[model samples]
Target: MTQSVLDKAFRDVVIANRILANEGVVDAYGHVSVRHPLDPTRYLLSRSRAPELVERGDVIEFDLEGKPIGGDTRPPYLERFIHGAIYEARPEVQAVVHAHAEAVLPFTVSTTPLRPVVHMASFIGARIPVWDIRDSFGDTNLLVVNMAQGRDLARGLGAERVVLMRGHGFAAAARSLPEAIRMSVYLPLNARVLTEAMRLGEVKALSRGEIEAHASMKPDDPAMWRAWEYWAVRAGCGDLLTARP
Candidate 1:
């Protein structure tokens, strides 16, 4: 890719990390990554740093096998495999956010399904599939620590934009950084609202048709950009707009 295009891509990936942290989608433990601008087989992710602290210098390139490219290695996220496997499985997904958002966890461990209750968050696709680590690993720590576990999680995610990891957290996918950040931020909001609504009994989530309406919209559409701009500014990361390769 040209220098400008590549810089823009990496800048957005770094901004996404901060934006998600500022929006409470990710804090110390979560991470965000983007597909390589020039090479589909590679991606850009931050070193093992807190999402809020990620900067341009912290970004590193990794191949499909989750190995750092260019021999410039800092420690990668242990779950870097998650990003790699998902990118391998879903070509259209350009960004991924893995966060341990608390609101979404209740539903993953319960019978209640996390459904979208409002229009903006109705982009929440699928019935919110829950991936149980034990199903394959069989009684181990609940981390997608290896490529095999990451691929299994991807299998459960299927075409959904979000997948809840039972007793762990959720992964949000999108065609771009902003959309994935939006999904990461909104999944917990949807869950919080749904949980409160359930207290009144029989909550009414958006219908499948309502959710489907946004399926055709581009991930970088105006709505997504508008929200991203607001969040980026609020997070004090507006410098991303002026960043160059």
Candidate 2:
């Protein structure tokens, strides 16, 4: 049972890496990570390869401090601190995705808050918090390059499941890989829809109660599997025949 769990986590991490790219949730610059099944204090992430190219072997183990433990020779992402600190902060979250989505960028810079403009995004509730790196550490490269910066960002993130970095990108956290990938994908789609609707007229966003109901509910597993399957196939996942999980 333990081996099965570990194997599934590893494979799902690979699937999520590819799914995010195939779904346009991430391109060359973004990244994803999944909590280690054998040890909660560690995680699985790829060396500095592009998302689409992250094969199973490219995945490396990192401790809670985000230090590579498996002697992985490839360069690790500097922003890995982003994933590390969030995992430390949120024990319930097993998956994390970070992306610089074009559609989400406007809301991060403007006073216009990104809301639950669609059903798939109702889990985002009434507002997605924006973490202004400038307010904490002014006038430098925007990357959360170190553990201290990562902790500060996590503090800003607080209880929210998603956070938008001012002048940078956004992070999505979930209890499962599919849900994390789903949020990463929908954030941009929701942003695009909201942007267009804003041009047409004032948009009526989902109500707090509506968002609350969805939050209280169990995830629709079949729907999630379908999404994962579609993305897995589209991304040319190595073993699509039995990849669902």
Candidate of highest TM-score: 1
* Model 1: lDDT of residue 135: 92
The lDDT of each candidate is: 0.87, 0.85
| TM-scores for candidates 1 onward, in order | 0.96, 0.94
What lDDT tens digits, residue by residue, belong to model 2 across residues 1-245?
Answer: 89878777777888888888888878898999999977989989888888988877888899978899966667999899988999999998788898998899999999999998799888765668999988878996999898888888888888888999998999888877877888888889999999999999989999988888778644437777777777788888848335454
Q: Tell me the lDDT of model 1 at 56.
A: 93
Worst 10 residues of 2 by lDDT: 236-245
- Candidate 2's C-alpha runs over 4 A off are 238-245
lDDT of 1 by residue, 1-245 (tens): 39988888878887898898888877799899999989999999999999999999999999988999999858889999889989999999899889999988898899777889977788878578999999999997898899999999999899888889999999888888888888888889888888889999988789888888977888768777888888889889887864221
Clashes of each: 0, 0
